[model samples]
Target: MGRSTLRFRRPAVTTRRLIRGLLAFAILAALGWNSVLLAAGNSMQGAKKEEGGFEGEAPTAILIEATSGAVLFEKNADELRAPSSMMKLMTAEVVFHAIKQGDIKLTDEYHVSENAWRRGGAPSGTSTMFAAIHSKVPVDDLLHGAIIQSGNDACIVLAEAMAGNERAFAEMMTKRAREIGLTRSTFANSNGLPDPGNKMTVRELAMLARHIIQTYPEFYKLFGEKEFTWNKIRQPNRNPLLNSLEGADGLKTGYTKEGGYGMVGSAVQNGVRLIVAVNGLEDPEDRANEAKKMLEWGFRNFEVRTVFAENETIGYAKVFGGNTGSVALASHEPVKVMVQKNGNDKLIARVVYNGPVRAPFEAGQKVGVVKVWRGANVAVETPVYAMDSVDRGSTLRRAFDGVTELAIALFRAGVAKL
Candidate 1:
């Protein structure tokens, strides 16, 4: 027999890595879609609540049901105003984001920069997390000082530790605030310094607070700390509500020569959670009183009704390919509707989607939507998708499906050309 040579080459490392990365990407895409379907069902869309019953509200005031991000009442919720110390909410957000990314561990020590000391201990700084220069402060202590004590010194130390300098870190805070829908906000410093350009709306501040509390529940309790010590100096929490209000868990307070008194307050009463942010007040007492009244009004007037629950199968979808012909559809979290004391109970909960999602389906793939309507108007329309996977079909099955799909496409295309 004549000698024959056949060469076989194994896949290159890059090819293997690409395949692995693509597979991982696909898996993540599926899971993310599933999460959206589960959460998107909880949509609350309505025309701006009409000039609420209450008035004389601060030039800027907002009351939102925390769990559902529903605005119960507002005068100038979206109007731009200085966030005051409420800007720290974003500072805290950046710090938390670093902690999560592992860039700065909770136990990591932060070095105190001279600029940090000046800005934090500046004669202008209302709350100072006292820190001496050339000292290594643990991450956890810095966080407590910034959150509980509203210490500027502590904030700068954290900013420097996380971003090399306070000014650079403040830019990070501004970027994150914008990403989270705080469109009206501009940050000039790590702390809420009084500058013409640095400002935010009560609505935006409330939204930021809600995001931190919800996304980082583990570290959120740090906001509720009553007292904190740094450099052996202990300071009491300035938020008076934490002591008197039931379920008055946490939040932050702010004061400045130009900004007057301002606060972003959160509370939970009777299982109902609320966030209220106020600014441009004349005094601390006024700020506290205004927040309390706003929260009380929200609790007394609005109520939450669950329209769908997570994992609760809303319907099934026809899926082509893989091991099954049909896949289940469900929300990851409960869907809720917040309404006035006596508004509309006749809400129409409906699901709509194109039939038979084609295969290569991943759990949580968005294939359709759930829309909530009150008579002729849509209360909210939440996008939804598949919550599980449907692998490629067998050769024979795929051939049959291809023929069927071709026929359907031809019919649809012909009609559209009409």
Candidate 2:
């Protein structure tokens, strides 16, 4: 979101008037001084926004609050591109769910097939942990290779172990992606290797990262592991931020001739966490620096403001033909907003709903939305629910109220004409 600066100007007076109206000019200037101060403050705030909200060099990028899912910045984030190895997040997710459901165990071992060996093995000249042919690898070691080492062979082996083959496992990945609310992503393979159909938006990648972090906390630590060893060969994690940026932790990186360099990185500083996704960069250092910049911008420029506590009444909504005249409206979770810092624009919240809602509304029924605005941008929009149920009024009372409502409407219309 962007904002414009405000400027103030004083009225001009002629020489003839200045001699006769010195007192009046002084008074006018005194009155206008407050306006000047307000405009200057607005200008400073606008400058801060311009400087702090810079979108980095990545063609597609997004930064979000890990806990609240509030987007702090976005640039072409919804446009689809090849995800490369970034698709491994979903692959990890599938295995995480399978393990949680007792369908698989980390101790389970799978035989590395020749396909995985040749395509993703050492001879592939791509990233790998160099799993030997016909060797048995445990699910735990394979995950380390896939996440920390970015080993394509490890991904294929896990895919085969989970769904019998990479193609079938890719189908499961797509299905699970849809189930997890990734609408714009499609998986052509489990490893996110280059393919015509292997594409994902930056927003989708960030969302998938959030889901994995929140849903699979027990397994997410594997992504932060610095090195993993298999077959007496040790490989370092490809995620660049872990070494250079403080508080940088688990995540994965990707690169392909068709997809470009990209990374989905998450970090927590002082209990506030941010997740960033960046893609389509020519250089790995550029990708790392841009992702770090995006995350730091989010942490520095935006702050979380809790507007209302959970179940606390925000306001009352008028009711029509109900046992009561009104009902309290509130949010199920604490309403929080990611506000741009150093901005004089006050955050304004308004309850929106069809007036005089009909009776018989149950408790917790969704009535409307509490829309909070900052300048022209919507900071947050939270669902407002009825705090208490309201039953229908007596038939006689309902009839009388209906007529009264009509009379009020008619009178308001009549006043508008005046």
Candidate 3:
């Protein structure tokens, strides 16, 4: 219900340059403050290239710190475009989830139907594992083929075995995508061949890649394999990052006449992992080069800094009719962000919740989130919870609080009219 700005005083910085840069900042007020606000800046789409910021060649791209899911840089990251082969990441996630849930096993074998073979196999004139028609292949081999070789046939066979057909499987992919926080991505086929319905933003793709890396570490290593051999035929991994970037690991790549070139990539350096996604590039070399550049730049420029410790009271949310007027909020996990090591960058951290919440809530109940921004992009966000239980307040206290809220609402309305 209230917002305030906190600025960091850069040591020995020139005032003229500081004024021109106008970077945002966040500083927690003294403990027991009821309300505080953090500044908001331009969205990534509108943020201009600063003096030291990385400018990527891809039209849509994002770079983030994997541990904290912090946005280091982004450019048109939410604009949806044909995902091409990058949609395979969704397909892989579904299979991994099914396996984890015991609905399927790696040893399970799926039939290579004529439809799968003819459309996505050797005869399809597309990327294929040369899966023979009527062959029964185990899920393990299929995953290897799909991931290491970008085999369309392998994806179709798994799709048919799992959900009766690729269409139904695509629906499952979209559903699972939403469950994992990929809200804007949609799927039309198992292998991401070409469909108007298959679209994703680079931001979601990066998030998906991070999810796979973190949730299914054992399965994710398949993406980094240099080669996969099946039916006596061998093919190399399609992701260029593994070969080009040091410490680069698993992920996927895509290209189409309509979608251009795209890829999702990750790497670890100094124990810090970073995820990068790029799309809408005109050339394959540009796609590879741009992704590589972004990853290297992130590793070189950014470092994680703890903003708030675990169980540290971050701020308070107003409570209606509780034992007290407000509830203290804190995250079970330490709050962290990725910032430039130079300490020249500014950030904004805010406690966001809809309240004064009507209480009688238990301690540790999730109430809201702490969102921290670096420039215009959200650097990190983590959920905050009630630090202690709040029982119903006395009747007189409730009535007084209600009257106070009513007065505040009326004042806000009058101000709006003015």
Candidate 4:
């Protein structure tokens, strides 16, 4: 055997220490993970490991029923966090509204200003549609770019075109967001570039997703498109569910150095739709996996049961000064709830209202709430409206009823003291 100058080279001791330190941090973080409470649990309670329910890695998440607006699962859903590319959904919604209002046309063309091109276009160190400066791309093409491709460049271009500048466009986005009921969210830019001012809660993001799907069904299909080609370059949609999951259709994904990975995903299975939003994930795979798990959990673990038919009386509320002693309450629409598979019939319901409601209320007046409790947690709350109109009672009757209500209150208080 020839004496070969073959020797094994070992990694530097410092490098080895750094790798070990990183691995250790990951393990400790997993072990120390502070999970939020599930249904009926104390807010400060520590994580209780359970199966067949949502116990995902994302620090914050929410799953909502698209039809009934019933929250299936939530973990820190109201905590404000960076929205990342998810903000583009709002940007697209603004454009969609403008087109719908005839303020802009799908065929209308917008100039790709140098500011948009240099900062967010292909030249910028971010996702871009590769839109050329001074090019006039149609509103429709840019919509696809911003949504399907998640191109920041397309967002900036459309923003400037719509509002003469990105700052003003962001103002419009914020205003429009509030108009659409996203009160806890704020938009600093059209494409959701890393800005401290851009913040949204997982709950509000789900609300916005549902709004887009319901309000703009015609344009919402753009989100499901797999790919878009512009400036001779093609890019696939960043939304992960559209391809991997069967009913996954449209939505957006987001990531930044500071915000980590986030997603707003929706899917429809057997006429039942679910919207899921997640944030604060360190890995993109984790975001995708968590989103899929939540949507599936929502569809699998819960089912919608109509508790009250439209115009069917759910309960009654006392009327102190009305022509009648009480008024029947009913749901204007079919009141439904998402409950555990065998648990639908076990829901405990109660009509909650202040008073004896006042007299002279209309038949359709919303007077009370029908709250359905599942275990210790409230599963759903349907607004119960007055089923029939009631005029004011006569003077003698009103005085008598008022006195009687007062007597009842005093009696209840006396009994409690015993």
Total colliding residue pairs, candidate 2: 0
Model 1 lDDT, residue 277, Cα: 88
Give candidate 4 misplaced runs (Cα > 4 Å): 1-51, 342-346, 352-356, 376-378, 401-418
Candidate 2 C-alpha lDDT tens digits along 1-418: 1222222212222443454355445433422222111112212244444655575799999888887677777889999999999989999999999999999999999899998988887878878889999999989888888898888999988888778888899999999999999997998888888899899999999999999999999899998889888888888888888988889997988988888999999998878889999999998989999998888877787777776779977766777888876788898998777767766445666677776778988999998887766556556678889999999988887886687677556545644654
Note each model's CA RMSD in angstroms.
13.7, 12.4, 10.2, 20.3
**lDDT at 281, model 4:** 98
- Once fitted onto the true fold, the runs of candidate 1 whose alpha carbons sit more than 4 angstroms away are 1-52, 122-125, 179-181, 309-330, 343-364, 368-383, 387-418
lDDT at 406, model 4: 65
- Residue range 241-354, candidate 4, lDDT tens digits: 998887999899999877789999999998899999999999999999999989988888777777667997777777778788778788888777776663433456677777
lDDT of 1 at 324: 65
Ranking by TM-score: 3, 4, 2, 1
Name the better of 2 and 4 by TM-score. Answer: 4
TM-score for all models, in order of appearance = 0.72, 0.79, 0.86, 0.80
The weakest ten consecutive residues by lDDT in model 2 span 34-43
lDDT per residue (tens digit) for residues 139-200 in model 3: 99999999999999999999999999999999999999989988888999999898999999
Better of 3 and 4 by lDDT: 3
**lDDT of candidate 3?**
0.85
| Top-lDDT candidate index | 3
For residue 245, give model 2's deviation from the true position in Å: 1.3
